[model samples]
Target: MKKKLSLTSKIFIGILLGALFGIALKWLPSGTLKDSILLGGIIKIMGTGFINAIKMLVVPLVFVSLVCGASSMGDVKKLGRIGIKTMCFYLVTTAIAITLALGIGKLINPGLGLDMSSIVTTETVIAENKSLVDIILGIIPSNPIQAMASGEMLQIIAFALLVGVSISILGKKAEPVKILFESLNEVCMKMVGIIMLVAPYGVFALIANTFATVGFDAIWSLIKYMFAVLLALGIQGFIVYSGMVKSLSGLKLKPFLKKFANVAGVTFSTSSSSAALPLTIESMEELGVHNSVASFTLPLGATINMDGTAIMQGVACIFIAQIYGIDLGITQFLTIILTATLASVGTAGVPGVGMITLSMVLTSVGLPLEGIGLIMGVDRLLDMTRTTVNVMGDCACTLVVSKSEGELDLDMYYSKEENNIAKNA
Candidate 1:
């Protein structure tokens, strides 16, 4: 019998091939065929379609799965406990991530000896700085339907929790509603499986489009800054997350990473944690995280858990300060950590949102916003790397929470058998 490639292997191959294809397009002379037909036309359409397909599932999956998960939890107290734990884990990890980034940034000195005058200043749009009180208040949706339509994730999460709690409180009377949500949740998972069938091709197109437009040249100028961000992301993803899974959950790291490889690939290619939510939730369930846990934590994580963005802000802060020849004292360093950690909660899980939040971090510590423009050229590539880290953080937190709550299936989690969710679907 011939062996077949697994989805993980296929996605990896797609990434490699896509990089090569993109480089080939980059080297070719600019023309209608190279720039217009292939790069802008086919690649653009395919990549956008793939992203849209993935995004199509996020809102429905989050709302339905979360509702089902909440309703299934008979004890509202337990739900509150889980919520508190998840939030604490997210905030602490984010703080740790930025701290790590700051340490690494100082050691690497990514912006030292830079010729600031030669760098092109890209325009940056700073996000409005929302106070903590405002952010907390914004979570409660006055009109949930409007919140859902606008895709205000925190508001949607708030509304979903309320609806789910009502269903649980009603018990027998609300059985039909709970059953409907469960069915919808299953349908959403099936949709995830269906969409994943095209993920390899989608990964290819997305990666190709990125490299085709922003080639290797972009990294040459800010190579040290880029290296700093990449290094921090790598440590956070591999070492920090791995340690958390091992120490907290006692789960085997290899199996967890193997199972998550496909989702990581999708996250890397798309550079949006929100777009990868469906797969992230499905993968967690396959890894033996009960849906009640996966559904709740992953959606909430998608909305607020932003360790990766914090890492970037940390590194970028140090890099920008160095470029402008400013010395940050202990107070500034502490301020960066505090600001970035809280800012993660308000930050949306999308491409380039990090830069907007980065501005806020820079402002908090007195770094020039112009420094953002210097790194803008390479942010796209860095965004892809950091997004993978963000998703990994979500999974690690989910695993820890599930294990702590006794919601993890140990036998299933440690099972050596291949995960056939995508294949079987």
Candidate 2:
């Protein structure tokens, strides 16, 4: 009897085929069939549809799963403790990511001896800086419905946590509400499974569209800068995350990566952590992270855990500073680390948001904003790579928190049969 291919294997195939198909399109001569019908018409619709399908699940999944997780915690203190641990892991990892990027950036010197004439400088509008107090206050939703409508993840997380905590507080009195949320959570998970069935096709369309549009020329133009960012992302994803999983959770790295590859492929194609949240949660559960931990940590991670973005900012900071012939001192380097780390919390888990936050980091260190425009052409490809790293960080943190809190199922984590079921499911 022949064995069936797992979803992870299929997704990987989709990514590979999609890249090749896209490159073929990029090389073909301009025509209505290539430009109008295929790329713009079929590819665009399919890619957008796939992204929308995933996004449609994010708000409900986060709200419902988080409610179920929080209500089931049974102890507000444990919930608070988990929250602290998760945040610490995210922040620390982000700092380390930027520091790593800085180190690599300095060593690589990607921007040294660059041709300034080849660079295009576009106008970049810097968002008005917000105080820490403002960011903290923004988390609390005055009207949660409005927050949900706007898809404000931080606000939605805050509201769901409150609702979950209240259900726990009321105990038997809130039993019915808790039951409803649990049912909703199951439905949402099922929804994730159903949507994921189309992921391979969706990933193909998305990746195809991306490469078809962006092509390799842009990447070659800033090859050194791209290499710097990609290198930092690779270290953060493979070494940093794998090391943390081994040291903190005592889980073998291979199984974790194997299980996570499907979600990582989706994340890389979509370039949006928010879009990949459902799969991330599902993958964590497959790794034996209890939904309570996966629910709370992954959503929060999606919002604030941006190791990948911080890496980009770090490398870009160095690249930009070098292009402008600016010598950054210890204080400026320190400021970039601090600013990028904190800015991760405010950065939305979407494509190109990192570029905006990179502006803020550059501003802090007195780097010219026009330097951003220089790398804008290649940011799309880099964004996809970094988003994969970001989601990986979220899952790794979930595993660590789940293990420490006694929420992990060791049997499930190590069971090949269970992992097969999860991949097929």
Candidate 1, residues 1-425, lDDT tens digits: the string is 99998655676677678778988988899999997899778876766666566545555766775587567656435589788889789988999999999999999988776534232223222235566676668768899999777655556656777888799888999999999988887777777667667767776776676567666532343688888889999999999989988999887887799988999899988888989999999998988899998988888788778888898889898887776567787767776787677566556543334555665567555566555544544566688888889999999999999999999998788775434544566
Q: Candidate 2: deviation at residue 103, Å?
A: 0.6
Q: Which residue pairs in candidate 1 collide?
A: none
Please write out the lDDT profile of model 2 over residues 293-398, one tens digit for every residue. 8988898888778898899889998887776566787766766777677566655543334544565567555566545444544566677888889999999999
Q: Which run of 10 residues does model 1 get worst, by summed lDDT?
A: 117-126
RMSD of each: 11.4, 11.4
lDDT, each prediction:
0.75, 0.75
Cα displacement (angstroms), candidate 2, residue 324, comes to 0.9
Residue 113 in candidate 1, Cα distance off native in Å = 0.7
Error of 1 at 115 (Å): 4.2
